[model samples]
Target: MLQQKSKLAHFFKSASVIKILPIALLIIAIFNSYFIVNEGHVGVVKRFGEAKDQQNPGLHFKIPFIETVEMIEVRTRKNAEKMASSTKEQMPVTVEVSVNWTVNKEAALDLFKRYGGLTQFEQRILDPRFRSATKDTIPQFEAEQLIQDRASAIQGIEHRLAEEMEGFPVIVDNIQIENIILPQKYINSIEIKQTEKNLAAAEEHKLERQRLEALRAVNTADARAKGILKVAEAEAQSILLKGKAEAQAIEAKAKALKNNPLIVKLTEAQAWDGRLPMTMMGESVMPIMDIRNANESN
Candidate 1:
């Protein structure tokens, strides 16, 4: 009877250990299943295949069997791609490009949860959209335009990408066409054409500047001539006024002389003031009488 009791106690202890062993292991696993979310990463939690709101970058507790977590990098990342283009004159060229991009962290969890997942969205949608946008936009521009208007082209591509990536948690930092390889046959021709255009534009600008300068000089000379002519005309008017004043004075003097009938007599009295002792006539001195008085007496 004691042997039977001892065997039953041993069985019960062994079964209890067996039952408690799984619970202890489960508790350890639940405690150890946590993951860290870094500064530039967002965490997505799935509870029984259903997605939850984004988990922050701190400690999080999860049910081991029912929950899964995904971490998505949200920092700016680069993708280098190669493309081809043609010039306006139909010269073929190859261009290599680098695109710096990032996923928007605030919308990361929702994006991953709603639109398949990060990998699916990036592989199926983002990659194709980027390539398509680049191909479409690059082919529209000439080879040299890639070099000359690279900034504008980059901005256009970024804007197009933003529109295409609507509702997706993505941002394009920049798109740079790093290297452009042109066919050797077209290189010289393209350079010559560009040089000619630049020279022609410079010559036109110089000619325009010269024309404006000539016009300014002509206007200045004309103004100076007009100023000198005005001065001469003013001087002439002054001289004429002075001459007229002098002429008036002379006429007034002549009128005064005419009004004084004794002017001749005064001249004769002035002439007689000097004593005259000799006559230079060949004949003897004779007395002279006034004709008007003699006629009146007769």
Candidate 2:
């Protein structure tokens, strides 16, 4: 029960405060007056509905009931839209372009003077200039180039856009192309062409690999054949050298035999065996010996 009474009292207090707020505001407005410019926004002061001065974000003194303040945002804002245009090939194309822009703080008064308001600044001046820039730049590129080298086309569009808004109070920060819608027939053809190119490249790579393998096999066979030939040549050379050495030894022996004719008798004496001939020599048998060299030595 106490909690219910406390809640009722709080509700009545809030109601009284809401009722007293308007009268307090009216008295304050009649006596003292000031304007507060918000962050990222600039205040445009007007006297008798004429542009007077511009104020930065802070509190500023103003005459009551005589002066008014208009706020315009100076912060960056993004706008994206699908811009339709034709290419040099006369093919219709649609592209989404996003633009980041901001209004100058110092030019707030001029923007107010010429455009009157934010709606007029965007609808009357900004939109027309953007459309003109887009139409002027896009038609210069071919449809194929727009699909293949889309970056270049987007860069050209951005440059032309910046040029169109050069002398205005609006600043273009950045521009990006989000999407491009090409014809279905062109897309299909491109995919087919890419697939064919990939297949051709694969076939060429396979042929190159086979050629390299064949070259390696040929090199290995040639190396084996050369190695066998080298071994055969080495063996033939060794046999020839051995035959020459043997012939040289035989020639030396022939020369010695030519100089010493008694070598034959010595060899015969040495070969003679101490035994009687196979004749009936009986018990008086004596061994036949060649003693010619014995007499010569004596």
Among these predicted structures, which one has the highest lDDT?
A: 2
Off by over 4 Å in 1: 1-36, 48-50, 63-68, 85-90, 114-119, 144-147, 151-163, 201-213, 237-298
* Count of steric clashes across candidates, in order: 0, 0
TM for every model, in the order presented, reads 0.60, 0.59
Give all candidates' CA lDDT scores: 0.79, 0.84
- Residue 69 C-alpha lDDT in model 1: 86
Which candidate number would show the highest TM-score if scored against the true structure? 1
lDDT tens digits, residues 1-298, model 2?
9999999999999999999998898888866589899999998988889889899999898887789989998999787778788889898889887778899878978998889877788888777777777778778998778777878877887888888788888888677778878789978987899899999999999999999999999999999999999999999999999999999999997887788979867776789897744434336568556566678899
Per-residue lDDT tens digits of candidate 1, residues 1-298? Answer: 9999999999999999999999999887877578677787888888888888677787777777778888878888888778776655576778777778787888888778667666787778777788777766766677678767887667767777777878667777677878778887667887899999999999999999999999999999999999999999999999999999999998997897789969867867878958754434445576444466568899
